[model samples]
Target: MTINAGRHFVTIDESAAGERLDRALAAALPALTRSRVKALIEGRRVALAGGQTIEEPSRKVKTGERFEVDIPEPEPAEPVPQALALDILYEDGDLLVLNKPAGMVVHPAPGNPDSTLVNALLAHCGNSLSGIGGVRRPGIVHRLDKDTSGVMVVAKNDRTHVALSKLFAAHDLTRIYQALVWGAPKADRGRVEAAIGRHPVDRKRMAVRKSSGRNAITDYWIEKRFGPPLHPIASLVGARLGTGRTHQVRVHLAHLGCPVVGDPVYGRKSRNAKAPAALVDFARQALHAAVLEFRHPTTGEEMRFATELPQDFSKLVQSLNSVK
Candidate 1:
C-alpha cells in the first residue's frame, strides 16, 4: 500500500472494494497521481492478478485482488503522452516557467478541448504537476489571452500555486510587453489610469468604464517611431502593467487612440486601411510578452525570463522600418 519508485503492485482490501480503479490505484500508490494512473490504465499498462489487463479507469475494484502498474520511463515516452513540444524556460520541483507562443490557449475550454498549454504540461511534466479539485491537475496561476504571446509561469504543486497566486495578488512581480500600435503616444511616456469592464453592447469586447469595472493601469512609452517624425504613422511601444486586468493592455492602449497593430477587434479606425499591405495585414494581434520577473516560490531566488519576438513580429517590425 506504500508508494515508492520501486513498488508497483496494488493489493486491494475490503475498504477498496467498489472503488474506482484509478481512484483505488492512486490512493494505494501515493507516488503516482490519479490522472497518471488513469493514463497508465488506458495505455494498457496495468494488469489484474490473473494477467488480465484493466483499461477502464472507472472500473470498480474487487477485494483480495492485486493490480500491477507499469510506469513509463521519463524520456522516450509512448503515444499516451501528448506530442506537443514545449519551450520550457525553467523548471524545478515546484514550478515551470515558459514562453507560451501566440495563438495557443492556456487552458482547455469548450472551443479548445485539447492541444492546450495545460495538456502539453500534463505530458511534458508528467507526474510532477498536481493538486486541483483534490486531483492532480496543473496549477495555472495566471494566463495570457490565446492571441497574446508572452512569458508565463506555471506552478507544479499546491505550495507553489499558493505562493505564486500571492505574488500576482500583490502585484509584486514585474511584467513587460512590447506592442506595435497604430500611432505614437502624444508624450514620450505616460500612464493610463482607468476602470475596465465588459462592454455593455458587445459581450466579447472589454472597454474602459467610468463605473462598474475594476481599476486598470498601463504605463506606456514609445520605443521607436515609423514614418515621418513630425507626423508618425506607427510606433513600437513598451507597456508595463500597474494592474493585471483582462485585455488591459489592448483596451488601455486602444483608449489612448493607439490600438495595437493587427488587432482586428480594436484597431478599427478604418477598415481595409491595412496600408503598405505587408506592414498592416497581420494575421493576429502584434503584441508579445517580452519580459517576466519573479522570485522563486520555494527557493527565494530572483528569477527573470525574456523571449524574442516571433518571426512574424520581427518581419512586421522590419517592414515598418522601410516606411519610416
Candidate 2:
C-alpha cells in the first residue's frame, strides 16, 4: 500500500476479503469517512488495478485486489452567503460563541436548503473559516437541534475545531440547560443514568434502552414548580449533561415520566390538558441551553457564558403564574 500525491493505492489482504468496496476503502484510508469513500466511488474517482471503475459502494472485493482512489480537491461550499443577523456573545481568531435562536437551522439539509447558521457564518466570517470538516460544514464543531435555542460555539480554524471536539468528547466542558417540563419529579433533584439509542420501531425517534444503547447520564434539579404545590402542572428544571448523546436530556427526562413541554416527538399531549393555556400554546420544546463554560482552545483561559430565557419562554412562565 502506498500513498503518493493525492491518490491512495491499496492491495486488499485476506483480512479484507469479501468486504464491500466502500468499507474496504474506509478501513484502508482512516482519514476519510465511510460517506466520503462512497462519494469518491460514486464520482468515478476509484478504479481497480487495470483502470476498471467500480461505481457500486457495496461491491465485494477479493484478497490481493489492487485499487487506486484519485482524491479530488475539495470543492467550495455551495451555500450562498446570507447577511443574516447573529447574536454574537464572544468572538476571537480561534472561535466564536453565539446564541442560536429557535427555528434557525444550523446547517443546510434536504428540507432546509438556505438561510442557515452556516450561511450566516460564511457571510460574517467571510474567508476566515475552517474547512477541515467539509465545504458544506466549514466551522461547525458541535450542533444543537434546529428548534433547541441556546448558546453554541463555532470554531474559526481547524486547530480550534479539533481542540473543542476533544474537550466535548472528554466531557470537560460545562453545559447547563433549563427546561419547562410537563410534570414534576418526585425528588427535588436526581440523576438519570441510562443508555440511549435509536428507537427500534420508530427510526426517527430516540429511546432509552438498557440494551443496544450508548451510555447516557443527566443530572437534573427542580428550579420552580407551577400550579398547586401538591400536584404541579409543570416544573422548571435545570439539567446538566454528564454524557452528550442525541436527545440525551430529552430522552432521560421522558424516561423519568416528565417530558419537555411542547416536545412534539416525546411529549404526551394528554399532560398538556392540565397546564395553563399559554404553556400548552408554546411551540417547540421548552428547552434552552442557558449556560456554557469551557477553556479557550487557544488562550487556555476559562470562559463562561450565560443567557436569560427568550422572551417567549419568559412570557409563558409568567402566564403560568397568572393562571388562577
Q: Residues 219-315, candidate 1, lDDT per residue (tens digit)? A: 9999999887876778899999989988899999999988998897887542434346765668889999999998998889999999999888888
TM-score computed on alpha carbons, candidate 2: 0.78
The total number of steric clashes, by the backbone 3 Å criterion, in model 1 comes to 1
Model 2, span 202-248: residue lDDT tens:
54577887555678889999999988787888889999999898888
Model 1 alpha-carbon drift over 4 Å, by segment: 1-81, 133-137, 269-274
> For candidate 1, what is the lDDT?
0.80
- Report backbone clashes per prediction: 1, 0
Q: What TM-score does structure 1 among the candidates reach?
A: 0.72
Model 2 bad stretches (over 4 Å): 1-77, 271-273
